[model samples]
Target: MNILFVADPLEQFKIYKDTTFSMMREAQRRGHEISACEPRDLGWQTGQPVTGQVRDIRLTGNADVWFTETPRRLAPLHGFDAVVMRKDPPFDAEYIYATHLLGQAEREGAAVVNRPASLREHPEKLAVMEFQQFTAPTLVTRDPAAVRAFHAEHRDIILKPLDGMGGMGIFRVREDGLNLGSITETLNKDGAETIMVQRFVPEIAAGDKRILIIAGEPVPFVLARIPQGSEVRGNLAAGGKGVAQPLSPRNREIAEAVGSALAPRGLLLIGLDVIGDYVTEINVTSPTCFQEITEQTGFDVPAMFVDALEAEVARGN
Candidate 1:
């Protein structure tokens, strides 16, 4: 199998922490050839497909790095059995354009996991609102009056950008919190983006659970992300600790509902965040809970993911 990853520059990734690197490593171990290129590498040549520089990728264990040489341009989007869209996000305009290009590749018969159309339609936070019955109170608005009303109603609310990822700009506004004005001003400047105001789930003090779903089935393990002292965000990138945790009945129910809803849409991978019994977020773009879950539970998530990808590729062929 020849696999191509549409992702960030290789130098920016910490080998162990990056799910793309982990998947690439596992794919290589399974005897699949791998290469990678950024979204800018994709373009059409006179209505004919053409791609910018692509380099062969190699990963070694102890060194925690990838080795690549000068890139060579090639025909766009053919010859690869699978293309993994693993770009990290703020999900800006560039990301959407990349999805459009990838969707074209999918039409050409490549097994693009999570389906490009589905990825474009689903922004991580907004997509989960479709399952509001299973989630905490959430409000998407930019009006200061509306946000203030929500804050007054909930008393404890979390404010975050609607399209942000990796827990960026996530804020918890407590009853006595004083910075709402500044926060709102910053988030709303330039008429840039709307913020998500959610009723803060207090169960977060215990931990935030991240459940990984592959091929529409929930992996057996969950990561309980406990925030550091005085921290309100429970994201690993935000100084939270990930401990292996088992799913409770409620967690399983939420996962089952979300899985059943998404599987038919060709979203082969997802990571769902549950704080207490309330589902907080549904991560679709390059979700990553696999490493923490595997490290704690001894589950072979990489192998399972590879198996699912292989199966999808087989079906495409």
Candidate 2:
């Protein structure tokens, strides 16, 4: 089987902890051919199949440089057995356009990991709104008065932009409500942008747990990113300390419910972000944590992912 990864530039990857790299390694172990391309490498013409300028990559065991790409050439996406969309987010206009191209490739009979329509339909932050049973008290609004009202009701609240990743632009307005107005202004952009406001879950002191689910099943272990020092964010990108641990019963319950609900939506891989018992986000675009959990708990998260992908590919065929 040949697998084409549509992700960020190969040069920018941190192989030691990168989940996509882990997937590639496991795929190679199974004797599958691996290919690489960025979203920009994809294009479509009237007469051509939705195509990408891709390179066949052979992995060497070198730590600093793990992969060597063969000469790049144009290939239709449908030529590959599976196409993995591993691009990181701020799912802006360009990302949406890239999905449009990938959607075209799907029409050409390629097995794209995340069904492109679901990706467009399920924005991570907004995805939680539908599953209120497992989520924290949350609000989506652009009006300052509404945010102020939510803040007044829940005193300690979190305010964040709709499109931010890695904890950027997230503000915690304490009971005192200091600078609440200003925080709302910055996040909502004075009524022009919509922002999410949720009652702050104090269990954040425990950790922001990332539970990886494959094909609607939960992995037994998770990467709990505990905030360090005075940091309010528990994202690994925001300097949170990652601790791999077995999922609690509550964790599994939430995973079973949420993961099953999303699997048929064309979301093969998902990361459910749990701050305490409440789910904070549902990540479908690029749900990570394979390396962090596997290296510590020996869970073989990437292998599970590849297993799901392989099954999906076979089913598609």
Candidate 3:
């Protein structure tokens, strides 16, 4: 199988912790050919299928330089056995444009994981709104009055932009409401943009748990990213300490429900961000923690992912 990963630059990957690198390693170990390209490399023309300047790569065991690559050459996306969309988000216009190209590639008979249309449909932050039954009291609005009302009712709340990633632009307005108006203005851009406000779930003190669901089934272990020092965000990118642990019953229930609901829609891999018993986000775009969980729990997450990917491609064939 030739697997082409549509991801960020291969040069920027921190091989020790990068989930896409882990997947690449597993696929290579299974004797599958590995190729890669950045979203920017993808191109489409009227007469041509979606094509990308892709390079075949082999993993090197070196710590500093982890991979060796061939010179890039243009290839139609459908030529690969599987096209894995592992691009990280702000899910900005460019990313959406990449998905549009990938969607066209799928129409050309490419097996694209977590289908491009599904990625467009499920914005990680806004995706949670669909499953309010498993979330904290959440509100989405651009109006400062609505945010202030939510803050007043909840007393302690979290405000975040609709498109933020890696914990950027996240704020907690406490009971005192100091800077509540200011934070709202910053997040919502004074009625120009919408933002999400949710009642702060204090269970965050334990950790923000990342529950991975592959092929509509919950992995038994989860990576709990515990916030360090005075930070409210438990994202690993925000310097959270990741601790791999067995999934709690509540986590399992939420993962199963959400996983089953989303799997049929072409979401083969999903990461549910759960705080305490409630899911905080549905991370379908480039979900991580594969290396952390596997290293800590010996669960072989990358292998699981490859197995599912292979099965998916086989089914598509």
- Return the top candidate by TM-score: 3
RMSD of each: 1.6, 0.9, 0.7
lDDT of 1 by residue, 188-222 (tens): 66246687889999899888899888888888888
**Each prediction's TM-score versus the true structure:** 0.95, 0.98, 0.99
Clashes of each: 0, 0, 0
**Candidate 2 lDDT over residue span 1-317, tens digit each:** 99999999999999999989999999999999999999999999998899999989989989988899889999999999999999999888888999999999999999898989889999999999879999989999888999889988999999999788888998999999999998888878778999999999999998999999999999999889999999999999999999998999999999999988999989999999999999999999988889999999987898899999999988887
**Per-model lDDT:** 0.83, 0.93, 0.94
Clashing pairs in 1: none
lDDT of 3 by residue, 1-317 (tens): 99999999999999989999999999999999999999999999889999999999999888888888899999999999999999999888999999999999999999999899999999999999889899999999999999889988999999999888889889999999999999988888878999999999999999999999999999999999999999999999999999999999888889989998999999999999999988999999999999999999999999999999999999988
Span of 10 residues, lowest total lDDT, candidate 3: 182-191
Model 1 stretches astray by more than 4 angstroms:
50-52, 68-71, 190-192
Q: Residue 75's C-alpha lDDT in candidate 2?
A: 97
Q: What is the lDDT of candidate 2?
A: 0.93
Tell me model 3's lDDT, rounded to 2 decimals.
Answer: 0.94
